[model samples]
Target: MFEELSQYLGWTNCFPEGESFLVIAEGTDCGFILQHFIHTFLKRKLPVCLVSTSQTFSHYSQAGIKIGANLDKAREEKSIHLVDLMSKFLNHYTGQIECDWNAKNIYLSIKEELDSMEISANSILIVDDISVLSSLCLSIDDIGNLLHYLHALSKQRGFNILMSIPSLDCEQVQDTQSIAEHYADTVLCVKSLQTGYSKEVHGQIEVVKGGRSNCGVRQYKLSDKNLHLFARGTSMAVL
Candidate 1:
């Protein structure tokens, strides 16, 4: 689904073990980025534990189908494990299950899911849009502590972590996002073009690996079966 993006980013090898990967989606949906990671890791036959905070399992399954990765089949095969926080939250709201929707409980649940997975260097943990925790009335401290715990877990288990968050206005949210970025080995910042939407390009992605010293920006357009990456300032519409 993201072969061009992967090749451009030199993801020939799996992501470095035990590193945090952050993606900040601003003015655009970064679902494709998350999907890319899942598809890539699963294609490599690596175990993936996806923590879906904002979307349901079925939502991802449908997206996976479009990308040629059958998430439902993967789950049946135990190749992918899902921590469906969205369903948990919904059940709690509808008086179905007594779920303590706090950061501690969430962290413990995620830890439990990761524990159930076959831990190895090739394992990948993907968290879709962590900032949604704020909507559950979690404090900034709670979010910070959650990230710290996840990072520690990754280090102890030797698996890479991937997380995405929308660019937000609240200072507290931004602080939490910054903390994630500081801990990240690679950060992908996705933002809309100033000139607004174009048939040629959807948005720009600024890739920061290790640090800002190593950064590259690319324009991209999303399709049903591909993510077309363009060199900075170039457009495929003309061709």
Candidate 2:
């Protein structure tokens, strides 16, 4: 699965150069999958920037620390950066909606981050669950504009941006998915399926759009540490 994903992203060798990817995982553990993909496949030091509504940076941070602890080349090889837009914006608010002032502040902060990283060619931006942000304050069009801005920044800087959305949030899901389909270079959708009468599992990944050939739907498995993909015939347990 990693090989196919690497191929989809136009990665010719172990390290991919100058390509951006967006993956939408259906559930809460999307961050885990993202971290695993970067660490296991890239196996080199690259700049990774995660923009999320979620508070925990533990996954990537731990990966970095582990790699650093072992003094592995892969650890020293890549740099991990995180931007918590949700926490930054909603820290003051006790509720869901963010005021106009807060929203502007969040946007400014993200803009500043992008400006600072403009020179790195291999940088990656992971926007985990855009639906959370849209639900909090921004309208559909506003979110669209934000996505467009990010897309432009990725292209101009030659970096990749990975954005995730919930499949259940139909409205925001569609809106976010559309932005990705139209502007993103690649789109990966991770979902679940019922294999038979007795078993229901979370183990399917499909490339809905972007790039050349479709890898079709394949089986995926998630553990505490990594998200593994299987060939067409393999079976796995659900989360």
The whole-model lDDT of each prediction reads 0.85, 0.59
The digit string of per-residue lDDT tens for model 1 on 1-239 reads 58888876667564566777899999889998988888888898889999988998898899999878899999999999999888888888889999767778989999998888888886899999888887777788888888988988898888999999999898777887988987798888899988898987999888888777344688888898988888776786766
Indicate which candidate wins on TM-score. Answer: 1
Q: What is the lDDT of residue 238 in candidate 1?
A: 64
Q: For candidate 2, list the clashing residue pairs, or say none.
A: 45-77, 45-78, 46-78
Cα-based RMSD of candidate 2 = 4.9
Structural similarity to truth (TM-score) of each candidate: 0.94, 0.74
Number of clashes recorded per candidate: 0, 3
**Weakest ten-residue segment in model 1 by summed lDDT:** 8-17
Give the poorly placed runs of model 2, Cα more than 4 Å off. 1-18, 37-43, 62-78, 95-105, 196-202, 209-213, 224-228, 236-239
Error of 1 at 84 (Å): 0.9
> Would you give me the overall lDDT of model 2?
0.59
lDDT of 2 by residue, 21-93 (tens): 6676664345545654556434545556657676466545665454332213333443445566666566647
